[model samples]
Target: MASKVIQALYNDDDVLMHAVKKVRAEHHHIEEVYTPFPVHGLDKAMGLADTRIAITSFLYGCLGLTVAVVMMNYIMIEDWPQDIGGKPSFSYLENMPAFVPIMFELTVFFAAHLMVITFYLRSRMWPFKKAENPDKRTTDDHFLMEIGLHDNENELADLLWETGAVEVKVTEKES
Candidate 1:
């Protein structure tokens, strides 16, 4: 069976937020939303699950810290010890001050870079990928909300219009 969606266009973020609340209150299923800027509390309004990506970032940082510790210990204490500033690189604990900067830098680098890669993969935002934006205006100044249509075209369109949608249109969705 073919699917359908109702696209609602709003000029302002406030109106879009209001419309989302109204649609959700009426038990309508919203499929997606596009906004030029992030709308505060939109996810909560949409009833979306809280993201779990922060846990991955913490793990990535731990991996980087572990790598830095092992690498520094091997290079300075075991592989080739150096004597500089009257302090020999003979013990990791004794020369801990010198390794602090490298450890901090590596932890931050791993967290930031790995988090970005994970986000890109999770969102499928690969380089040169075609955008799924329904309208060009949505990328600029307009906000768009796509609601799943379940034999409620007229009812949903009327509700959207009442909620201050500038335009409402129904279209077939590809499986």
Candidate 2:
């Protein structure tokens, strides 16, 4: 049989934080927290490590810039060089400003597409992927804290209620 997990639902992040602080002070184990929008300093309170998405985004942007420069250089200078209005084609280095538009366009294109793809993959939000939200209201106006109870489940629920939980429910793990 799967063990049950208790979730305390709150309307405000402040209330949630108070509850987390209280529970942690009492050495209760917290499983996860869900919020509709990011609550500043909540991750620190929960002792979560910093996310690496910023570094990943920077790397992806650099890749896009490199691809743009290489592709533009290859096409305009090597593959099929063309001159317009008596402008030199063999030596684009002298007219580097002319390639700026193409470079910017390609950089934006690649960075946008790749960043979106990366975010989706990292969040496990592929096309047609069903979100595992336990309550529909959680996506709108509710903040939820999921705690695991090794013992004293009833007392914990009472504490959560005292700390401003709008509702408390126990959910059994799916087998």
Candidate 3:
């Protein structure tokens, strides 16, 4: 038997939540959810775990800071030291404030760029990636509930309609 995808569209958040609750109560498997804007508490309702990107971002920021400091110190002090304005430039530890701007910039730069790249990679998003969504209307103005079905397609469709779905459609794989 092949797996099938059934999508239920809803215009109201409360209706969507109610449908999700009903679907879960019936022990049906929900594959994924798509929304145009953030829905508060929807993740909890969908039983999704919290994202740990914040921790990753912090670690990446620290790495950036370390790189900036080490590179700057090596270039200005060890590799090619230059006496500027008659001041000793052998050790930057005494005047770390001079490097604060660069450090901050690098930290922010790394955190933002790396975090975005990580997020995109983790989410399976890349350049030239074709769309995986089943319904294009869901992206514009509707909430979608993607449910996997093993059998009993008509029964599931009726349940979804009774649960206040505006429309229901079935999506089959290409192969």
Candidate 4:
């Protein structure tokens, strides 16, 4: 069956946030939202689950720290020991101060890069992927909310219009 949805466009994020709250309060099902910029608290308003990106970042940081420690230990102590500033490279713990900068840099680097990659993958935003937004204006200055149609399109549209939507549209979409 061809699914139907209502698209509500708002000129301001504040209006969109309010509309989301109103829609949720009335027990409407919102499919998705598109915005030109990040809207704070929109996820909470939409009742979305908390994100786990921070946990992934911490894991990536741990992996990076482990790599740095193993690589430094092998290179400085096991492979080719160096003598610098009257310090012998005998133990990683003994020369921990000198490796602090490297450890910190690698940890940050891995966390940042891996987090970006994970986000892109999770969002299905890989390279060369086609855009999925219904309106081009949503990428510029408009905020769009998509709500499922459940035999009450008119009522939903009216409510959306009352919520300060600049434009409201009902369209059939393939399930």
Output the number of the TM-score-best candidate: 1
Report clash pairs, candidate 4: none
All candidates' TM-scores? 0.95, 0.84, 0.87, 0.93
Model 2 worst lDDT window (10 residues): 86-95
**Residue 68, candidate 4: alpha-carbon lDDT:** 93
RMSD over all Cα atoms, model 2: 2.3
- lDDT for predicted candidate 2 compared with the true structure: 0.84
What is the descending TM-score order? Answer: 1, 4, 3, 2
Alpha-carbon RMSD of each model? 1.4, 2.3, 2.2, 1.5
Give stretches of model 4 more than 4 Å off: none
| Clashing residue pairs in candidate 1 (N, C-alpha, C atoms within 3 angstroms) | none
lDDT of 1 by residue, 66-118 (tens): 99999999998899999867776878898889899999999999999999999
lDDT of 1: 0.92
What value does the lDDT take at residue 93 in candidate 3? 86
Model 4 residue 40 lDDT score:
99
Candidate 1 stretches with Cα past 4 Å from truth are: none
Let me know the TM-score candidate 4 reaches against the reference structure: 0.93
lDDT score, residue 134, model 4?
A: 90
Residue-wise C-alpha lDDT for candidate 3, range 84-152, written one tens digit per residue: 766578788854767799999999999999999999999999999998877787678889998887887
Model 1, residue 118: displacement in angstroms? 0.8
lDDT of 2 by residue, 1-175 (tens): 7777899999998888888888888888788898999988888888778988777777777887788788878888888888866778887685478888877777777778888888889888988888777788889999999888777889989988998999999988653
